[model samples]
Target chain A: MEQPEVAVAAGDTSDPLTGLRAVSSLRVLVESYELRQVEAALRAGMSWQEIADALGVTRQAVHKKYARRIDPTIAVPRRNRT
Target chain B: MSRLTDAVVLSQQIVVTATEEAYRVGHAELELDDLLVALTAVGGPAGDVLRSLGVTVDRARSAVAQVHADRLARAGVPAPPAQPRTLPRTGGGLPWSPRADRVLTAGQWDLRLVDDRRILRDLVREPSGFVAEVLAVLGLDAEGVLTALDAWVPTATAPSGALFSPDPRPWRTVTRRGWVPAAPAEVWSLVTDPARRTAWDPWYSAVEERADGVLAATLVGEAEGAKPVPPGFERQEVVPVAREEGRLVEWELRRPDRPGGAPVQRLAVALTPSGGGTRVDLTVRWLGVGGWRAVVGLLLRPVARLAWGQMLLAKHAGIARALR
Candidate 1:
């Protein structure tokens, strides 16, 4: 299994899709980083409402997304399909 | 090596409590919902996320109850009288369902830190499980939960306890250091000056010198909407109990609520020269509070430490400004 090519060369601006691809990849990285920070904040004993307040979202939205995912008793089984 | 393990085990106490909570909810077997409630109760990354999603302990309990009610209605059976959940001692000390046990065990494998968040991350990936049922109750499905979990990257920094502890204590303690780009003498001068100290001390609103050479200070509690301070916190007095010229200063911070019998906190600040600047070391220790208040104080120690750290950082910034 080969890793997908993501790195954009410094001077390679010839390919129109290259910039878009790089931007898309960067967006994923940023989202991952933000999620990681929220996890860190949670580990640091931050509350969901507190985290939501920081992220400018409703508490329910945050909980709905993360409540089960961050639970210690349940392991989300990996699936092949979305 | 044992000490490290002990620290990790001590931190993992929340898991045990979560397990207990699962049992209390009348669940014959510990499920993911119970675990989620436990995490929310213990307060960590998972708890925070749950709160953000509007899943509080009360809300989770109600949701579980509602699910039970719906099931009973569907079956046309009347609800039985609620009974206390007995800690299941059948499986050694753990009462968790077999699958839950396996997941928890896997979380701790390979020396990985098994926390509520870590366990939940693994559980969310499973399409069909008890967690899925709990998700459905919350108006969420397994697929949606998994998608969100997939997007999340677990990158929480090591526990703040791990930051300063070569050997972590059973209790929480915070140690912080700050460097100011100013001479030790200059920094110390400002630090020792009672008037300037109040300006940067996050907890102190005012500092006045008494006729007996003891400095009496009014201490502020945490900022509004932050962690709630103990009642009568504002009445506390921060009196300088010990001092060493341009080197160290110690204060006996007495809580106002306790008055004559209040616990005294010894806060020591040390200044040392480093690379044409000064490094400040602050140590805060709570003393002589026994019984229940001792437990409360222990819990509040971290909050107190945070306040002190913020004060010192501000003080350092002031010093930087003054020197310029």
Candidate 2:
């Protein structure tokens, strides 16, 4: 069977359709990668604030998103804590 | 109720019990060992078979623990003393391991629902893995269990269409909803247009509309993290069942080569305008299958659901990124 021609070339953001599709795929990849990193950081005893800083997000935002998913006891105390 | 419906209800109970067992053990995912313990607890022909073979809930639980300890010892890690802890259940049930998912769906399709006996048979049939390890810890082997199961029979006849009736619903539906950061029109176009599919949809490498208004597509391989098309089912014929321009689109995914075969999947997408974005509701319905192939297909249902959910999430993110 002949290969069908793609409407737009790979990584070609000139077309709105292709551009939007690329964004979605990239987002999925980013989210999966982020999850792995967060899990590793938690296992390494990183604090929520530290992980939030690494991701350039607010501590509350990161904590709210992941605190429930991971074991609470595994996370270390915030760096500011005594 | 029909035997299939009875099996379905029992299977669900087994899954719930298995999830609780996994949670109690501090395991993040439901494994085959947990299912074995669950089967013993959920009384039925499978439980009866196991009980007759001296496999009780308590015995299975201890065997599972011993297997875990043995594995840890083999890895040169000291096994922690058993500690009982009560943890709050997570919102959704624990995710099932791929192997466990396969075992749960290993029943013969002719039997309809994956009955308990089939699950037990599959568990014992495992040559290695958690189930096998646990069985070995219990001083039992696959052949011994298989022999026992073959010889076992129900003491009472299963109640037939007397009081309860077979469930009318045949297909299992999985629905996922996401907010895409794009206008309803844009999201609709992305979903309905075959030309733009490969861009956002990871499942297809190429999709072209046929003259008959059906879709013929080349599926991407599993390397791309997309669900693999079953062997000899490489060719797909997607016929649109219903559509509302810029709102909803429904299609029946079938295999053109398998003439007269029931549609394998039904997909429906509804796009609703929600504050500055589009709310995308994707529904995937798996049609029933019979014979041995159904085992493979049914087993992959959980994996397929996860894959579809992830794909939708990615598509939503991409649309948002592009629009932003």
**Which candidate should be chosen as best, given lDDT against the real structure?**
2
DockQ of each: 0.01, 0.01
After TM-score superposition, the amount by which residue A45's alpha carbon in candidate 2 deviates from its true location, in angstroms, is 14
Give per-residue CA lDDT, model 1, range A1-82, as digits (tens): 1122212232246754444434433332344345556656777778778989998999877766555333232222331111
Q: How many backbone clashes does candidate 1 have?
A: 25
Cand. 1 Cα-lDDT: 0.53
Single out the weakest 10-residue window by summed lDDT for candidate 2 chain B.
B157-166
Query: What are the lDDT figures for the candidates, one per model?
Result: 0.53, 0.62
Over the stretch B1-324, how does candidate 2's per-residue lDDT look in tens digits?
356655655666577667766655655567777788877765556776777778777788888777655553333334354453343312236677777888876654656434577788888776444576677887888778778777876564221111111225686766555444356888877878888766655456789998999889777655443457787577777788777777777888887777767546777777776534565666677666788868887888778766765555444433432332
True contacts kept of 1: 0.00
Runs in model 1 deviating more than 4 A are A1-82, B1-13, B26-31, B80-94, B111-115, B125-128, B153-324
TM-score of 2: 0.41
Rate residue B158 of model 2 by lDDT. Answer: 24
Which candidate's TM-score is highest?
2
TM-score, predicted candidate 1 vs. hidden true structure = 0.36
